[model samples]
Structures are given as structure tokens and as C-alpha cells.
Target: MMTVNEVSRLTGVSIRALHYYDQIGLLPATGHTDSGYRLYDDTALEHLQQILLFRELEFSLKDIQRILSNSAFDREKALKQQIELLKLKRQHIEDLIALAEKTQTTGGTIMDFTAFDTQKIKDYAAQAKQQWGATPEYKEFEQKTALKTEKEVSAMGGQLMEIIAAFGKMQSMDPAAPAVQAQVKKLQDFISEHYYTCSKTILGQLGQLYTAGGAFTQNINAAGGPGTAEFASKAIEVYCRTAK
Candidate 1:
């Protein structure tokens, strides 16, 4: 048996965190000392090992607690999972190390993104353009946006939220109504300003994505409840057909 402090010193975990774990019933005390201090036995040591392993793998404490509470939780099975995950992490780290070494050999500093293969850069740009669109003035746009900080993103998000709210207000209006069309134009302008130039193909694809893509629909639904994406799709499609 060992005191909580002894366990903390031996395990390198903070004493407060161990107390928290005990308070949450994750690593319950095996018995109390005469002085009312907590004591842990070998069983608790095994559980602590599992907890530490899960924490190292980035599992939330709650998730670790739930995993360990299950009667079917098997130590060997969990260890096997940990081994597989650690192997993958090791491979990822090795790849990063190779990339770093290559960069050093090529006289490329950390921020020298041009050191990356042009093909990889082109592929990423193509994917982004497909998802959004192109602005011929994008170089200028990038220059303007390069200095934007976290605070600016939060402020920009607020403006977008307002635009989206106005969009929601127009949902019950007739799709063919002049007001709805006007709102759709505003939506197009919104995307153009924040993203890039709007293309017909991208617009059509965005409409389809609202209904067909899980990620798109999930984001829309999560924002202001469900059906927002479907409504936006209809409004955009109607706008596309009628716009000059």
C-alpha cells in the first residue's frame, strides 16, 4: 500500500490530479490510514497505469473514466490498442523528423513553405479553389488578410453570423419573391467577399452539398438547428436561375 503523495512522486502525476481522480471514483482508495489519508494497493496501481496510458493518447479524463468503468474492460485488449496507436504515432513522428532533416539539408527554414514540393502545393490550391472559388486579385487579398489575428477572425465570424441570421429570416418568403432573390444576391456577395470570386459550378455544387454532404449539413444544422442548409440551398438555386 502507498500514500497518494508517494504514488504522485513515483508516477510524476501532480498530487492534486490524483486527488481529483480519487474524488471522481476513477481510482478509489483501497483503504484509509489512521490519520484519514488515502492509501492505494496494486489494483489501484494497475488502474492508474491505464489512466496514464489513456491520458498520453489524448483521451479526455471523462472518456477514460467511462472506458475503465465498463465491466468488460480488459487490460490486455486495452494494452494492444495502446501499442497500435503508439506505433502509428511513432511513424508520424518519424515522417516529421525526415521532413525536418530534408528541410535543414535544403537550407529551408521552418517558415519557408516554398521548400515543399510544387505538386503538393498545386494540389492543395486546386482543392481549395474547388471548395470555394478563385479571385484574380487573390494575391492582393492574401496580402491584406495575412496580418489578421485571432481577434479579427472572431469579429469576422460575428459579421457572418449576422448575414446568416438575415438569410434565416428570408427562408419562409417565397423562393421566387424579389426579397428572397435580393437576399440570395447578398449571400453570393457574402461568399465572394470572405472566400473569393463566385463561379457557377461552385455555386451549383454548394447547393448540392447542402443536401448531399454530411459535413456541410451537419455544420448548418448545428449552427441554428436543422433544415437551415436545405432552405439555403433552395434560396441559392432560385437566385441562380433568376439573377441577370
Candidate 2:
């Protein structure tokens, strides 16, 4: 495990930015040391690499989180898209450089502004974003959240965590118990009501994400204590299996 500072130095990301990412449920540390220092494992580092790639493409943090959090996200496919976008960006820059040189040679009197056009890059990016976020659930989430204030969204997140935390308190009980299954149903209902329609398949995917050792796991553990995320994941698994 590497310290947060070490990660910051390695990735050239600011310590403050990393902390903010943690706060916003982006790139959470894989675990914490006994002394309360944040620690990241190789998996977390790989996630960070993906985030940085999206950042390089000028994606907003919110968009990056949404894209990465999707259970269907494909890292290799995303990498290919990022490479294509970067090549376009590089070509744009080269065009601008050539324009600048030509203008300089012509005594800076050229009035042509065609080189300033960036419609191609912008259109490609828009198309890529649409492709990545085209799921019905994602569309519903976007529509629902488009009207909410940031504070309201944060409150909703807190409420969801509270439900997960409840699972932590029931860790001693059988995960397949009726009570645990009810809680899983409640979680699914909450997601369907507020964010998107949470089908059994989606719920199962979320269960995996809850214990996938990233911000979701860290935040759930922070709220409910250690091992809570795993317990909830188990409960979810049981719920999905029985409900089907």
C-alpha cells in the first residue's frame, strides 16, 4: 500500500485534489493505516489512471464519476476512445501551429479564421459521451439530477449511505434472513424512486461495486464500520437470487 502523499507525487495530482476526490466519492483510498493515514493499492492506482485519462479529455469530475461508476464500464473500450480523442486534439493543435507559422510568414496580415474551428473535436467528444452514457438508467439519472441542487444531491447520497449503514448493524444476522432481504428491497426501491430503475441485474452489479475496494466500499465502511460493505454485498446477492 502506498501513502496518499506518495500517490500524489507519483501521479502529479495535488494532495488536496486527491482529498477532494475522496470526499466526492471518486478515487477513494483502498484502505487506511492503523495510524489513520490513507493507503492505496494497485487496483486503486489503476482506477486513478483511468480518471486521469478522462481528465485529459476535459471531462468534468461529475461526468467522470458517472462514467466510471457504471457497472457496464469497459476500460479497454474507454482507452481506445480516449486515444482517438487525443489524436484528434493533437491534430487540432498541429493545425493551429501551422496557421500561426503561416500568418507569421505573411506579416501577420492573414484574416483567415478557419483554423480556429473546433467543431470536429467538440462533436466527437459529444458523441463519445453520449455513447458511454446511453443506458436507460443513466438517462433517467441525468434527467432526475438535472433539476436538483448540489446540496440536495449530497443529502440524497447521505440517506443512501445511512441505509447501507443499517446493514452494518445487522452483520451478526444471516444475510439471507428476511430482515436483510427487506433492507435490500428498500435499497432497490430507493434507487428506482430517486435515481433510476434498479432492476435485479443492476442491483446485483451495485452489490459487487459496494465491495470492489474503491470509494464505494470505503464510504460504506466509513459509514457502517469495517466489513459492512461485504455484508451488504452478500445480502444483496441473496436478495437477487431469491427474488428471481
Candidate 3:
């Protein structure tokens, strides 16, 4: 058990915020001491983590409370999802920084494709392949695709999209439902078959990416309407927790 001050110090959340959270039924203290001092247990700490993550993602306190109070709230899965989303956001920022450097060298026109020279692109590809070839996922992908043609790869891609559409259809279902879990498993396997071994960590990262903007999010939203990506991400959360 940790005192309120301890939790505040550990999480960098202000004492006032903690009191407000408890006041609002958001992050209630798990227990109390002999002098009636608030104390937090592991579960309370976990809830606080979720609350912080949602706040970082700009979710309103009301929504975070609702989500955390939900019967199906899964702490481990939620933590993984938050970490993945933050990492993706960080990566996007890094990419923007790289592009900014390129822009500086080209007088900020930002329209010059010449910066991406053919040899540079090829070299990058070679370097990526060399680095990733050592990973189990990449080795499996390389071995599986060694004899596959471009046509077959494209066909597999279409099938994966079909499964994504199916996910949209079942967006309203509880993510822990067997039906939803099956689709998540299919998604994992399909990725492993076509691209790389879809480890749970990577799969969770992709779940976050489903709404990471660009055509991917647009297409997913078009498939099942807005919030479909969130449904898929939650489904992935369930899958990671319960998968064998």
C-alpha cells in the first residue's frame, strides 16, 4: 500500500488531482490507514496509469472514468495499447524531424523528390533488410516469401483487408467474445503469413496504427464508420491478454 503522497510522488500526479479523481469517482483510493489516510494498492496504481495514459491522449476525464469503470476493463492490455500509441506518436515526430532536415537543405520547398535519390532509397532498403533479417519475424517472412510472386503477395493483401472488413462488421461485439478473438487471431496469422511474424507486441502496435492517420485510418473508418479503428484496437487488446 502506498500513501497518497507516495503515489503522487511516484506518478508525478499532483495531490490535488488525486483528490479530485477520488472526488469524481475516477481514481478512488483502494483503502485507508488507521488515521484515515488514503492508501493505494496495485489495482489503484494500475487504474491511475490508465487514467494518465488517457489524459496524455487527450481523453476527457469523464470518458476515462467511463472506460475504466467498464466491466470489461483490462489493465494489462490497456497499458500495452497506450505504450504502443505513444511509441507510434514518437516515431511520427521523428519522421517529421527527418523531413524537416531535408526541407532545410532544399530551401523549404518540400516538393523536391530529388532528395530521395534512387541509390539512397535502395541503400536504405538494403540496410533495413540487413538489420531486420536477424529478427525471428523477418527471417520467417523472408523464408515464406522467398518463392512467392508479387501477384500472390498482392492477393494475400486483399484477403487481409477482407478480414479487416469483418472486424468492422463486428465492431459492436465485446472484444473478448470468441468471434472477435478468432478474427484477431486471423489478423495475427495473416500478418505472419504475408509480412512478418505478428508477435503480440507488434500486433498491439498495429492496433494503435489502425488510427494513426493517413489512408489507413480513412479506409478503416470507411469500412465500418468512425470509431471502427478503436473497436479493432480494443479487440486486439483482448486478444493479446487471452491468446495462448
Candidate 4:
């Protein structure tokens, strides 16, 4: 058996973290010395390694606990999942780096944008340009956004938050009301004028996306206040039902 300090030295995991893991029942030691020191066997080290891998992949402690404790937990399967997620994340970072290099000022260092969806955002930006660049709305939208400097984009994002805040104000009302529907229309128009032509189907998906969590959900909830995402989602569902 190895002491907590031994594991820390060997794996570079802090003793504090290991203790927390034990506190959370994540990586309890196999035994304890009579003098009250924690002792971990070789099998416990393997479990710790798996926990570290999940942490590197950004899995929450609660999720990691459930997964590792499950009877179906398979080390090989987990490693494969880790590999795929890492590759996808690396690709996103790489593409952002390449794009930043092209548009950046001379010698400007690439800023960390982990909270931003570099790939997904770029994909949405290109969607209309690829699908309907010939349409006047797309052309007009492209022209407008094309002139936006980085500061303008930031400002535009702030304006978008105001729209979301407006939606939050209507949360107590029935989602099928004319007022709610009008706000939904405004939201659709906002995307069509700024980004892409947001049809009812796409609008519905965007509502779900807002509630899906991450920085997007965080920003929406922060801007519009709590329950805003769910409110918008319910409103979008009602709007889509009416459209059909």
C-alpha cells in the first residue's frame, strides 16, 4: 500500500485533491494505517488514474462519481470516449488558431476562447452564405455583418442580450399569447437580419440550445435573469405550434 503523499508524488495529484476525492467517495483508500494515515493499494491507483482522465475531459465530479460507480463502467470504453472528445476539442482549437492567424494583426498572440464555440459559431456564420448567398436577405445580412469590427460584434452581442431580457419579462404570461408570439417573431427577424434566415424549425432548435447549458445558457440566464432560457423555450414551442 502507498501513502497519500506517495500517490501525490508519483501522479502529481495534490494531497488535498486526493482527500477531497475520498470525501466525495470518489477514490477512497483501500486501508488506513493504525496511526490514521490513508493507504491506497495498486487497484486504487488505477481508479485514481481513471478519475484524472475524466477530469481532463471536463466531466463534473458528480458525473464522474456516477460513471465510475456504475457496474457497467469499462476502462477501455471510457478511454475511447476520452480520445474522441479530446480529438474533437483539439480540432476546434486548431481551426480557431488558423482562422485567428489569418485575420490577426502582425505578431498578435491568439487569445484563449475556450468559452466561445469557435467551430459552431463559424459554421452558423457560413450557413446562409453557403446556402442562400444569392438571396437579397442573405446578401444584405452579409453586407451588414461584413462591416462589423470586433468591437461592433461585441456590441451586437450585448444588444442581443437585451432581446433575451425582454423575453424574460414575459415568462409569467402564457407562451401562446400574441405578445409572446410577437417577441418570437422579433427574435426570428433578429437572426434573419443579423445571422441567417431562422425558420420556425430552426428557431425551435435555438430555444432548446439556449437551455442546453454551457456558456450560452450561462450568458442567457445572466442577461435575462434566471428561468429565462426555459421561458424562451416554452414560447418558441408555442410559436412553432401556431406556425404549423
Local error of candidate 4 at 46, Å?
Answer: 27
Ranking by TM-score: 2, 1, 3, 4
Clash numbers, per candidate: 0, 0, 0, 0
Candidate 3 residues 37-151, lDDT tens each? 7888776786687778878755556445434533344567666656665665566566667778978888766764543444533353344224324556656765776787644
C-alpha lDDT of candidate 4 relative to the true structure = 0.68
Per-model CA lDDT versus the true structure: 0.61, 0.84, 0.68, 0.68
Top candidate by lDDT: 2
Model 2 C-alpha lDDT per residue in residues 47-153, reported as the tens digit of each score: 89999989998987767877787666778888998999999999989988998999888876678787888898889888878987888888998899998876566
> Candidates' TM-scores?
0.45, 0.83, 0.45, 0.44
Model 1 regions more than 4 Å off: 109-244
Clashing pairs in 3: none
Per-residue lDDT tens digits for candidate 4, residues 56-77, read: 7666564465456333445677
Candidate 4 C-alpha error for residue 218, in Å = 1.5
Off by over 4 Å in 3: 1-136
Model 2, residue 82: C-alpha shift (Å): 0.5
Global lDDT of model 1: 0.61
Q: Sorted on lDDT, highest at the top, how do the candidates line up?
A: 2, 4, 3, 1
